[model samples]
Target: MGVLDQLRKEADQKKLSEQETVDQQALRAKLYKTQVLPKMQQIFKYLQELAEHLNYLEVPVQVENYSDRFPRLGTLMQKDYKINTDGYGGFSDFNKLVQINLTFYCIGKGELEYNVQTKSAIEQENAFLHAKRVASKMYRLGGAGREESAKFVVTKKIPVRVRFEVDYEQSQIKVMVNNHTDFSTYTEVWQPADIDDAFLDTLARYLLRKDSEFVSLDITDEDRNELRKKLQSIKHKEEQERLRGVTEQKNSGLEKKEKLGDKMKSFITGKINR
Candidate 1:
């Protein structure tokens, strides 16, 4: 091909690419305005209402805008808030404080995802220990000490989530709730038609209910048995050590008493001899 012809073709292709890029940007902006922005606003309002509800319940809560944590794409954003129950004397009367996190993700195509998680002030292992301690007190520990005494704590958190998506092409709103901590599996708790006033009210009420009734991690039979066994073994070892310490103290006391008696006898004998 001629040099001029090749150059012309390259220029045409570059122009076409630029046009396509501009078109894609325009489409994304349109989607964000029509689909994403409304949902985002709705979520913000819902969060405000939720915060008010939590305040009414006397729970300390703070909402934060975390959209800057992601790229400023305008099509996606996130907001996070935390409910601090530390002042409430922690979970189940434990000294440790528990913070509940609520994260809202606004995605393109009219999709809003909400995640509710339990945040522990302690390490994951200690969280499991606390759970085990609660389980022990609640009598939820089954067959741990009777069979295997090695597995004492099974710690995990299953966060709850609610997802709302608008299928513009399909002309329907898809709503799903996964109230289980195990993200791998989802249980459909509620299905709403549209993000209308009624739906928003219902969603707010549902979230409030969840806030009051915290998510509980599911402990399988195997885990329960193992935890019980480990707790039993620990208790048994502690008891043994305590008994050993007491026995040693008693023996030491006896030895000291015998030595005193011997000394008294020697003194009396010397007196008699004298």
Candidate 2:
């Protein structure tokens, strides 16, 4: 090939590559502006409303915007926010508070990743132990040997996790419980536009309910039986106390009546003597 023809071809290729890069940049900017930013704002607003509901229920909750974590690109870096139940002032009844992390990958095709976490290592360990116990029980009931059960069924860690992904393509929220590979899965989808205050309130309550279940995973069958016995004992004591109170009232009333009769009799005797 001629030198001039080769030089021309190289120049054309360079120009085409630069144009493609520019086009890709423009597409990303448009996606962020139109879809990503709007969706992020909507979710933030929803979470803020949810926090209000939680506060009304006297649950310590805080919603934080974490833009400083990823600082770059136009108006916002990434839609990274966290809603955490603060365990302070002895307010949290549960041993562990739920921490929800919602992050939107805006640089890509706006996918929202939802993760639930807790800081209580003890609770996690207890849950793992309880899982093993339950697994062993099930294996025994199924006529499987204890050694086989221990080897096959018992996992090292029972990390209590609930994950959901906002699928924009299908307009559905794919929810995975405990582990992704588990058959226990469901979809909880809400249109971005349709998410209102009522929805947020329900979502907050649902999250709380799930969190409580996760925390209570440590309670085994033995613990439940013990609790049942204690409750029965308490009821029996209460019944005894009620009966005692009634007896005391009746005895006091009879004593007062007898004293009144004695006074009347003494007055009558004194009058007759006079």
Q: Over 4 Å off in model 2, which ranges?
A: 55-274
What's the TM-score of each model vs. the native?
A: 0.34, 0.32
Per residue, candidate 1 scores C-alpha lDDT tens digits across 4-100 of 9999999999999999989877875666556554654564456556755555665432222313322222342212323222323232212221122
Q: State the lDDT of candidate 2 residue by residue for 1-274, as single tens digits.
A: 8999999999999999999989877875665445444554454457656546554665532222312322221231222223432312122212221222321121222222222233254345346447523221112212333221111233222122333334533333333343211212323333344445654555445454433322223345576466556555655765786777844535878779656755655543333221
The 10-residue segment of model 2 with minimum total lDDT is 133-142
Candidate 2 global TM-score: 0.32
Where does model 1 exceed 4 Å of error?
A: 58-194, 205-274
Best by TM-score: 1
Q: Number of backbone collisions per candidate, in order?
A: 9, 0
Clashes of 1: 9
